[model samples]
Target: MTKAHHIIIVGGGAAGLELATKLGNKLGKKKLAEITLIDSSRTHIWKPLLHEVAAGTLDSSEDQLEYLAQAQWNNFRYRLGRVIGLDRESKELLLEPTLNDEGEEIIPERRFSYDTLVFAVGSLSNDFGIPGVKDHCLFLDSTEQAERFQKNLLNRMLKAHSQSKPIEQGQLHVAIVGAGATGVELAAQLHHVTRLVSAYGLDSIDPAEDIKLHVIEAGPHILPALPQRLSDAAMRELHRLGVTVHLNQRVVEINAAGIVAASGVIIPAAIKVWAAGIKAPEFLKDIAGLETNRINQLVVKRNLQSTRDESIFAIGDCAACPMDDQGNNVPPRAQAAHQQAMTLSRTLVRRLKGEPPLDYTYRDFGSLVAMGHYTTVGNLMGGLAGSMMVSGYIARFVYLTLYKMHQAALYGWPRAILISLLHFLRKGIDPQVKLH
Candidate 1:
């Protein structure tokens, strides 16, 4: 009997999970190939929604998908562990021993052999070795981090509300060290949630006067990767909403009190969130001697295969794929990852049949920024409508559809539809914002 082709996918991010589900249904269900997904976390949550999670505007527990449940339903095997090392010659991936919260080992160190290995481990916040950032500031890289920020925010608000004296200047301020989509959207989300907090019986605190939101950007403009017009619009909205935008300000250091800028401007904040930049996990740099970029992202060909190994592939923020001859690489985005996952799924299937791989060309459907209920803004690329800027309800609807698209990929249309309906119904019965 022919040995079943084994495909191992490391990391259960958007791209990794979708690829595993597709390949599992297409091959694993038929016994043509064995599919396994490995992730350090037991559940998966879309990374884009993390800002809302951090702001306490969205409850993560209600939205998370359990890895074990998804794997069993989709015909794939799920392993919980972090990849520590790789052996290219032996085609084995080494995993660190699983540990519980008390630091006791649950699963011993393990290794899995694979005919094909795909890396989708995703990215982490890039602190650039700035002083006090790693220890003093908070990050939104994972659900636990986001929830920690939310808990801290709640405790701070509760203390301020219960105290007799008036809140001090900058005592309730939030310093977000980045004006990228995450930072900007998080500022807006927090602004919206602060108002809701007062309505929910934290009436002693004035949301507009006590809660100050600061966005510090090293670049000249917010949303630097997007169009200038969109950036200008977002800037106008932020200013109107009382959010302070500090442009061209490089952060020199972060302390428990606030952030110090190289421009000699000091902003005092009780909470600081670092959303500046991203880099792939450190282990990826020169892992198994595979080519990688400065950010530790594995350099890949147009086909999403690593430059040095045909049996190895990468997607999402962990892969540096060239977009043009001028040396422009594909920008790390959810859309790009979704597209890559779809393309790689087909490529893997063809590989099983001894066929040539399909090349992937990123189609920029557009970019959308949802800032709570204030509004959504984005540009639609290509298509009959051509390039156009949109906002208001139309833009918000499209922005939500993006999440639906991601859900459709994982759970199919029927289940995705039911999930959406359940979410809507749950909102009516539950608190609009997460209080605990």
Candidate 2:
């Protein structure tokens, strides 16, 4: 009797979940391969939607896909643990003990052996060792964190509305550190949704005038990674919406009530979110002798395999795969991960047949920044678009389509369509923002 190949995947983000589902449906269903997915969390939510989750514009529960449910529906076995160590020699991956809310260990440390291993553990915000950041700021790195921010925001809104005194300066101020897509989108969502919440019987608080948003970017402008044109458009929209843009101001320290800029400006804020940068979880740094970059991302060859092991592969933001001779690794974006997942899905099937894995070269289709219901701006690359700039409704439609594509990957087109319909219906039945 031949031994069934065991494939183990760590993490449950966009790349990890999609790859597991694909292999599980394709290989596990036939009993040719045993597929297992391990993630620290029991549920998976699209990372890009985290800003909406944080701003209370979207209820995370409505969108979260439970891993156990997904595993049962597909053929993959799901494990509730986080990979902490990897033994390449024994082909065993070590998992840290699972802890409950009270900090009691539920599941003890465990290890799983695999014929093939994949790491898509994703990333966390890089605080850059800034003092007080870890203790004071909320991050949108996970669903729980985003929901925490939402609840806190709701509490503040309710308190301000029910109180007799007028809202004071910085009482409702939100200081978002970083002008990247996450920071910018969050500012827009919070502004739009907070106002909507105020209208829903919290009429004592005027959303238009009560809330103050301060976006602090260390760079010269917002959306520093995107095209300047798109950045300018987004900047204009943010200003039009009354958002305060603080460019080239570096936050040196975060305190209980505010942050101090490098220029010694004290910005008072009720809430502070660090969305500046990302680095892979620290555990990835040289784990089991695997090569990694400065950001702790596993270094990969052109084929997306770890530099030290052919049996292991890395993808998404966790892998430092080079894009070209320009010393540019693939940008950590959802689109790049989406494309890489598709390519690697095919490559894995080929590998099972003793075929060589294919090399990856990223295709930069475009980038889009959605500013809530106001508008969207981005540029399209290649194929008839040729640097064509798109804005307003066209860009917004495209932005919505991106999420639809991710949904299709996980649930297939038929179910994705049904999900979309349900969300549309929900708009009429429920409030646009998460109030409670």
Best by lDDT: 1
lDDT tens digits, residues 1-436, model 2? 9988999989989989998899899989999789999999999999999998988888999999999999998899999998999999999999999999999999999999999899999999999999989988999999999999999999999999999988887888899999999999999988898888888999988776788999999999999998999999999999999999999899999998898999999899989999999999999999999999889999999899899999999999999999999898999988888877778878888888999989989999888998987888888788865787899999888888989998899999999999999999999988788889
Candidate 1 accuracy as lDDT: 0.94
- TM-scores of all models? 0.99, 0.98
Task: Report the number of backbone clashes for model 2.
Answer: 0
Give lDDT for model 2. Answer: 0.91
Clashes of each: 0, 0
Model 1, position 358: C-alpha lDDT score: 88
